[model samples]
Target: MKIDAAVCSSARLARDRRFDGRFFTAVKTTGIFCRPICPARPPLERNVTYFATAAEAANAGFRPCLRCRPDSAPGSPAWGLVSTTVQRALKLMRGEREPQSVERLAERLGVSSRYLRRLFAEHLGVSPLAVWQTERALFAFRLLRDTHLPIADIAYESGFNSLRRFNGVFKQIYQRTPSEVRREGHSSRVDVRAATPVRLYLDYRPPLDWQPLLAFLGARALTGVEQVEGEVYSRSFAVDTGDLVRYRGVMRVYNDAERNRLVVEIFGQEGGTGLYLLNQRLRRLFDLDTDIEEIQAILKEDTLLSSQLRENPGLRLPGAWDPFEYALRAILGQQISVAAASTIAGRLVTRYGESFVDDSGTEWFLFPQAEQLAEADFSDLGVTRTRAKTLREFVAATLDGRVNFAEQSLEDWCTQVTSLPGIGDWTAQYIAMRGLSMPDAFPASDLGILQALGSEGEKAKPKEALARAEQWRPWRAYGAILLWQSLKSGEQK
Candidate 1:
């Protein structure tokens, strides 16, 4: 994946957004590194050094170029490489992340700490601890740059132990104090409205199918918890802190001219309350953090369904807001239209979930967890005794970790979800791809999708339909999204 030195120099000269975040260019004269898309004039070729990751550049004694604000460059899209270990590690870190040893975390990912460390080094060129630390620290750094929260509150919100540690890490990583960084920010953004609707810019790759994707979410959106306007979507979040946070936000999707990233702006929060969660949630939903180029390369040459390749090549199937909630929704979706399934899901949450309101008048139920749902008896809910029993088993399995997708490989999650009573191949594969973060998981048995792919060649049978999709190997999931959209335009929701 290394680039030619000359090519890197040319990319910097052109300020090409395509190369931004792919590599960092350090100026020997100034001892500073910046994204390739930095607006500053290119430096002498002989005096520059290019590194793959920010840490690598910073570790070699180069400070960040203040003009470009290297921290603002989009995060790398994690993909392609058999990164199951990486995905599993992120899940473990995000959920119940304890201030414990990496050894224990590694054990949870079913790999030795040393093996996990090597994986990080191999893919990201940093230790696993460094990756986790950077994820938190950089997020905190962005908050400091964007919001006016006090240092102590920022530390707690950023998942740091104390102000001292936060300051120390901030100085070490950015070569400056957090306050100093904030003070230096040039807030000339013309319409920089930071109140009520907190605006934060998030970036991603290009060629997104914004209209179709938004249309789908708009139709399926729950009544009280979510809203959609054109290409923008907003919702209420029950922060893990158990606080009800509301945000009035609209995302304008566009290719980042500077970072070659997909930039998203979230506005309408007084204190930037849920900006961090919004960033994570948007990353999952819009799938901005995916290596689509790598994925397209894998499925492009397959002979079976090559013609389907041209159908909205940049499609992204949105992921869930909550994993447990998504799992329950998948279970209820069996043999039902998406609209009907969504209605059932909304009812289940409203009836049994916790309710709260935010300042923005947004209301939501804290989606019941595995333990909570496991204890509930859904017999009188109008669903069959079979669906009720299925719900029971599903909840119990999640609570007991018997059906844990956190440790399971993509294949394992797909197989395990189907093994549950109500979940079949389509539902299981959908969960695996979206809920379990399995990129290669695709539900070939999907009826609507198969028909949308022009499967009814007047005489083709179900077996032929499966055979037709043989070429979409590994990334048939992308095609599934397009077919879903096709159905949507016809008001099939």
Candidate 2:
């Protein structure tokens, strides 16, 4: 997590958007840490110190800057460069409820608490508990500033056990009580019972090729379950909140390219941790946390990928909204055109998915869960018998816990997934790249990738493509995306 102070100083002085979340500038005089892109006047270099993460800054007794709101910055790139253990730990924490204790988290990770703590300390410069608390506090602070949710509800939603603890942590980190901070930001309070969509904004690093990303989603968008209109992408979601409770809702994401953020509108009966989970999913779906510059630096070294990289500078690896859903989609897509696969997927949703009607009487379909389709018949949905059998077996394996989406290592996960019947390297690699958010997962056998790498209207063999992709190690997923974009731009032979 070491940072170059000179580089940080220059980024801070230039208000560089690319370095927004890579590091934080902690001011000695103000005792506040700001994003590198903060609008506030530059502080003296002597008064500024750089921290690799906001948690590290908070651990050093520096408050988050109200102006820059470091919490809202794209996730620190340092998270991507950490050890596999830390990466898995972070994924688990962000994907679900925080484990009750470091012991519990360590147990789940199959490592001892002492070892897990050491990894966190070495990489993050903070304990696991510190990271968890900082995340919760910062999430609550964002809610206070952006939403009308009551303080108590915000506390519960943000993972705080009680209002007292929430206030204490809020004050400890932000140097102000929750109410005081809310008032200072002048956020209007509203009734908790009101049936209004909760709106929130997520920030990302700049040079986002937003239209291309949207086009990618729209092409494969499942009918009735997802819709893309104009610049907005909307979909229906069903998030399980345990105890047989589920929050079903529709969320629409709008591109705010001018501001370098996406404005998300959530239409649902809001209360509970579902909103928090939804936020994480949306961030992944958009791949907002990736460091485009870093990925480009490596890919641009090759002539083939370099041309595509220059054509689409800020292209991103589009992620899945749900792993199970995307895995099913991948299975459905095997050896078929994208349009044909999407047509069958739409039929599957129409048959097995749940219907949700919003206040406007507009009906939407929620993608079916594993249990919903475990034993269900898909023969009538224009699916081949072989594909149906594969789908059934995949769902059964998922239900029986043989296929875990939360697995840590990409190689191990891919191996386990490919072991399942009819699921090959391509499906597993696609799942890893988009579903699991593994940056290194590359499907060398992908037709589009092979075609993009070929010459004179010829497609390269999988072996040739894999060989050429060796130079893009640890970022082959992004390379795959660039290749796909090249096909769209007619840059490929």
Candidate 3:
């Protein structure tokens, strides 16, 4: 918590939103901690203490201020900080799939458990497990606030092992019974804005160009599974738990105009685990929370991506509707166009995926899981043996726990996928960018990227493309998207 005394003092004086998640001001006199952007009166400098997270502040006995829900604050931009391990860990905790253990996570992080523990303590001001617990409780809190499910069902839906445990923990932290929280919403209506109606608020950063985004998804729309019209993008899937969930949601900018959070209004069964799984996938798919401003500034220096950045700065590489499906499409469309890759993906989903009906429409099965694909032979599927082996290996790894996609660092994930025969840098990176939601990942060796750069204002060599991409910094993945879009446009003209 490197607090510059000057910055803290100024933020308190101005109540700046930019400093919101950087630190919290715990007022010793009033027993309250406030975000720098809190609407309340500021406390004296002598009576203040600073903490990094709401959990850490609460750990010190400061009650939450009602006016400002610290929990609702956008998550820390920690993706730009620390190793990818902590961010990856948070994703798993949301799904409750990967067991949460610091020692076990430490093993995966390639550092001793001791060093990883120290990293969390030093950087996040809390233990690794503490972050996971807070995430689960909050998820449960949101579900309880927004839904009308029975308590027993809500408990399990929020990833609690038992109803009793859920009650005890919710009561312990919120200082009230779960019933109280439910009662508060009973006055008029539950915030039933969208679960059954299939409307959801998806959050994202500002300066988004929605037309291009929708056009990209609309053109590549798959039959019976996905649709994109105007600002609405709806999709259906069967979750890992074999429950059918359909989400026909609308995307909206969050209320706090400065924040990048998209509020997704999900319409589904209150106890359904599938929507939770869908949120995990959608955040990566739309990638609205990404910081493209920083990315474009970096790419402005490079000749190849510079003009493209000017044209389509917010363009995001459309991520996979299904990871396995995306991997197959990537392999099958190796030398083809984006439209071709998308067509292949649609064929694979229609053939191998299932069908379910919801109010939104007929939702098709999610991309078949590893168990279904591992037994599938590609000889008759119109894919090559090498591609078949790569696809099968992906399926096998997921089933055997070698490629548990939910909870591993991007580097670890890429290494695991690349270790399979016939998967190289290109395939590995394509998977990393889409399959794993790795934003910084850049698949630069693509023939299209090479050709775009090579034929551009200043001719760049194929091998030099990687070096040229280095200037894009943490946003090379976005640059890759723009370059690809530029190539397609240039060819059409």
Candidate 4:
């Protein structure tokens, strides 16, 4: 990744929040890398060097700045801007329990290890392993700062094989031992028990349209499985450790707007690794890694979206908690209103979903797993016979390895998914947009989108809508979100 020194210098001096995770400032004199929004006095231009990723800076022998905590910054929005291959690789890497060998990872991505290494080198100025190592070390560091987990537990949870290795990695990256960092953090140690909830924060770039985002989730929230009360969004989650052990819990997230982060409180038996996976899921669920400004710049070119862009400056694409669950919801929602889909979904959950009561005595239901719904009947849940068959087939495909949520090109994934019976362009594109977090995925056939693009109270035909959306290519998903938001705003007025 090429970094324009002059541009970085200006942003560094200005402490621009927009540039926070886009790049990191490595000060040669201090041998430390900091976020662009670091509050420390700006370093002289001569001592400053910019790296497109914190991993690059760490590989360059720079320690993370204690003051700014680069690990806590939003993920680099610039990551996927240039290479989709790199983007896919990253998504895979973040969700892995242990970093796979380059050969294995490349095979999953349909690329040779050599070519994958070259792509990482060209786009991130680092090897894939270096990126993985940095991510692991930083995640452990975050655990140190945010939770009271024992250092040993943090080690295993952060994917370190042993306490010594964890210490060595922390020393190499942060120039401090895990114990030192924890002590410096000054958070009182609390015994982590199965029932005790752990609190953590997930940060994002500013101008987040938080309340509206919550409202969007609240409207589509499945009863018992999800609850959105006031400004808080809470849900029950189940994390399969891939080792035959599954952990269940409830998590609540609310905005900390003043600090530009969300406070996540987890009540579960998951250790570090499970929490790590949950973090990734929540980040995707809220679309926290997006650079809204950069996306808006492209979508604003469309006259249809421009007004909504101004009205909802930091609108985010709300993502699914689980791809399979959301895909089922989309299937249930075919030719139905949002409320109707949600009602059916809630009934499905009540039927097949696992039930648990938290310490507060509040009952919560986990979204039904594929196995649970595979042989189950949905006819009694108010689902039409055709829709019920589609749901069962979708679950069967998921179980038979016909539908994978793994890393793949959006077009390929869409083609593979739409091949199934009853799933069409709109459903596939909708899944791609939210389920797969594919930004360019757009459902041109969507009623709401067509209505929003239509003029004088006439709905645009899907063909016309598709043609008009051509200009929004590579960002059509955000365009879709803008159109939907605009439609909602119109209804309210």
In candidate 4, how many Å is residue 134 off? 0.6
How far does residue 264 in candidate 4 sit from its true spot (Å)?
0.4
**Model 2: colliding residue pairs:** none
Give the C-alpha lDDT of model 3: 0.63
Q: What is the lDDT of candidate 2?
A: 0.86
Cα lDDT tens digits for candidate 4, 1-493 = 8878889989889998888898999999999999999999988888988999899999999999989999898988778665888888888988856668899989999999999999998888899989988988988888888887778878877777678977987799988899899889854544545324677789999889988889888989998888899999999988886778778988999999989999999885656348778888999999999888778888888887899888889889899899988888888888888888899989998888889998889999999889887788788989778878878888899999999999777789889999898899889988888888888888888888888888898999999988988888778888888888887544310
When summed lDDT is taken over every stretch of 10 residues in candidate 3, the lowest stretch is: 247-256
User: How do the predictions measure up, each by TM-score?
Assistant: 0.85, 0.96, 0.81, 0.96
What is the per-residue lDDT of model 2 for residues 53-172, given as tens digits with 9 covering 90 to 100? 999999999999999898798888899889989988887787764335889889999999999999999999999888988887888888888877778878877877678988998899
CA shift of 394, model 1, Å? 0.7
Q: How does each model score on lDDT?
A: 0.66, 0.86, 0.63, 0.86
**Model 2 spans > 4 angstroms off:** 187-195, 488-493
Q: Show how many residue pairs clash in every candidate, following the order shown.
A: 14, 0, 14, 0
lDDT of 1 by residue, 4-114 (tens): 788888888998765666678999998889988888878888999887767667666777777886767765553234377876676566553224468988877778988
In terms of lDDT, the poorest run of 10 residues in model 1 is: 242-251
Which residue pairs come into collision in candidate 4?
none
